[model samples]
Target: MTIKLMQGNEAIGMGAIAAGCRFYAGYPITPSTEVAEILSRELPKLGGKFIQMEDEIASMAAIIGARVGGLKSMTATSGPGFSLMQENLGYAAMAEIPCVIVNVQRLGPSTGQPTAASQGDVMQARWGTHGDHPMIALTPVTVRQSFDLTVKAFNLSEKFRTPVILLTDEIIGHMREPVKLPAFETIHPYEQVVADTPESYKAFRNEPGDVPPMAPFGRGYRYHITGLFHDEVGFPTQRLDEIDPWLERVNHKFDRHLDEIIMVESDFQEGAKTAIVTYGATARSARHALKIARQRGLKVSMLTLLTIWPFPETQVESLGDQVDRIIVPEMNLGQLALEVERMVGRRKVKRVNRANGEMVTPQMILDAIEG
Candidate 1:
């Protein structure tokens, strides 16, 4: 391993290549354009392909098309662009296409701040697409984790046959740090295995294992692909019996293997009565406050969420039982805090939110801890 000074966006580009991503489709947007820039330069050198699409909508479409052709694909964008991709993002979920989406968040409700950092898209990442489909989102607190989680995002996407979102922020995306990346050769991404012959292959089979292996477009296993409710053979069907099975299988796949899907880092002191729950760039500030609180003889624990979606309910609920109160500091107007409040209780949760594109300072978290 070699330690090199790398920015978080650069790390994500490298991670995509390492994760066997051979195709990238994206439009240029601030805070996330570097991800496309680096991929454009590097993908071709490795015999991969990268394209600058007309817009976020086309970018999302291009990547989905590429993935259907059996290439591991990805796209990156900020809030405005992410908003444009939601329609196709939902399609990927319904069709069970494996792809990664890197959202390097900036302030937004309509391009609020292009250069500033914010975690304001937390809720949007979960519910941006108008549908009831399962979603997986991962956040990174450091430059290194950005690379690692980008790789994880691709792995999870392929393994689960779902679109995985790397929900980063402008802070982590632009921040430079010494990152020791593993050798590319040492990395092996997950590849779906098709056990059935082409004559009997069912693209959306609901079998013992709900995840059906995907066969690429030209693999002799031709099956229908659609955004509507699809039967096991991939044909669109309006029948309730067909639609219900697809819904149950698609959603239950995550439920059956949540232990492997949920990722978190818990640091709890023996007698800690207060815990800080955080993710993304704000986790840095939460960690700093935890350290100082301990140094000042305060009992404080911390839970850093690496996995954002399917929310780590069991772990957070257990933490609530141990701690008197949980402090959630995010760069949004209490989006994640609402989920925490639901898992624990509104009365047991304290929220420190910022929507003005500023980092939540460690002192602000420390004050919440002391108060």
Candidate 2:
């Protein structure tokens, strides 16, 4: 292991390489451009490929195609760029292509602030892509966790045969801190193994396990790939029998194994009546408030969400039972608070939100806790 001062965006680039990503294709966007910059310089050193696509749409398409051709692939973009990739992002989900997308979020309705930080993309990461599909999104509070979760994002994407989003904000994306990264060779990424012969391989087989092994396009296993609802053999099918099974498998795959997908950090005080629940960069502020609250004899706990999508409903629900009140701090105007409110209740959930490209500070949360 090597200890080094690393920025969060830099950590993501290093993590992608460590995760066995051999292909990166993206157009530059603020707070996220560093990921592409680092990868462009590093990928070629390891015999990997990096391409500067004309736009985010092509960038998303390129990575999917690279992954289809047997290389682990990824792309990075901000909000507007992320918007452009949504259609293709949906395609990757529908086609069951495993790829990682890094969205280093900026304040945005449409390029609202290029260099400003915001967690406004929380909902977009889950529902940005159209149609019903399983999505995995991981957020990190520290530089080290940024690297760690980027690797986790790739692993989950490959393991579940779905697109995984590394949802970050300008704060974590640009912030620098000391991180200890393991040797590249020591970091083992999950590889999808194809056990069946080409003739026996069914790309979208709805079998006992929801996740079927994927065979790359150029491999002897030449199977169809499309965005349409398809049969086990990957052919576009209109039959309810075929479509229903695919939908059931794809949608419920994450649900069936949610124990493995959902990750959270719980710092609980035995008699705590109030809890601070947050994710991404806001988690840093939440943690600080938690520390100060505890020091001042305010019995408060904190739940930091790492996996944002799939919501971690079970954990939040249980937290609701234990705590009298839940304070949710976010850079957005209470985006994630809605889910927390759903699990807990609006009455029990206190929201501290800011969407002006400014972070919800620890004092804001401390005030909420005291109030």
Candidate 3:
């Protein structure tokens, strides 16, 4: 294994290739276009497929189609493109289709700044789709993490039989850093849950794991899949009993597996009076602030979150019980801070947010730490 300098966007494309992703369909959008460009060049060399879709909606639909064809598939886009893909994303969710979506978030609220960074899509990644469906979002702070979390996103999607969102901002996507390419043995690829034989297979048949084994259409297991509520046999069912449990299982798979799914790195929290909670690129800034504050004899700990969704309630609750103050600095305007406030009770949480498409500096965090 050799370490080489790579952009975060290129790292995601390479990581997907290492994780056995064979298909990529996406339209170019600023800050995320590198992912599409790199994949288009690399996937063909590895005997894979890449298509420049007509639009984001078609791009999303095409990935879902590729997944059903038994290929590991993904799509990449920015804010406006992601918004266009939401309806189809909900389609993948309701149908329990496993796929990955890489959203390199740029300045938003209707395409404010295409080349600048923003974390405003944090809430959108959770609730972008029209309906109530579970989501898994992984935030990568470094180029290496951009590679690692892309693989994790695929694993989580296949294991849970749901769509997974890999959320990164423009700074992380564009910034270059050293990434060590893992050996083939180090790459843990997921086995697609394909059906065995031609007959005697059910796409929605529940096993002990609650997720049924999937079969592609050409593999001779012909089953219906639609956005409508489906029975165990994969056919539409109008009954509430069928729909309720389907939705419940969609959510339960993540909740029940939080121990493996939720990830956080905490430093010196045993007797700290203040805790700095952050994720994505801001987590890097927080680390610097924490170091400077400790030099000044301040008792401050830090929590760097790698997993953004499923909220990591238990971890945050435990950290909250011991700390008197929690500072959350993000690139968004109080998106994740709202969640921290809700989890840690009221004013115990303080928000340090900047949504002006610029990185929140270490000084901003130090100000919050001193305040």
User: How high is the CA lDDT of each candidate model?
Assistant: 0.93, 0.93, 0.87
Show where candidate 3 strays beyond 4 Å: 194-198, 206-209
Candidate 2 local lDDT, 1-371, one digit each (tens): 77889999999999999999999999999989999999999999999999999999999999999999999999999999999999999999999999999999999889899999999999999999888888999999999998889999999999999999999999999999989998878888999988899999998999645699899887688788888888898889999999888888888888778888899999888999999898999998888888888899889989999999989999999999999999999999888999999999899999999999998899999999999
Candidate 2 error regions (>4 Å): none
> How do the residues 217-334 of candidate 3 rate in per-residue lDDT, one tens digit apiece?
6867778999887887678899998777776676666666888789888886457889998999889889999889889988898988898887878888888899998999999888
Candidate 1 TM-score to native: 0.99
Looking at candidate 1, the ten consecutive residues that score lowest on lDDT are 205-214
Residue 46 CA displacement from its true place in model 2, Å: 0.6
- All candidates' TM-scores? 0.99, 0.98, 0.97
Pairs with backbone N, CA or C atoms under 3 Å apart (clashes), candidate 2: none
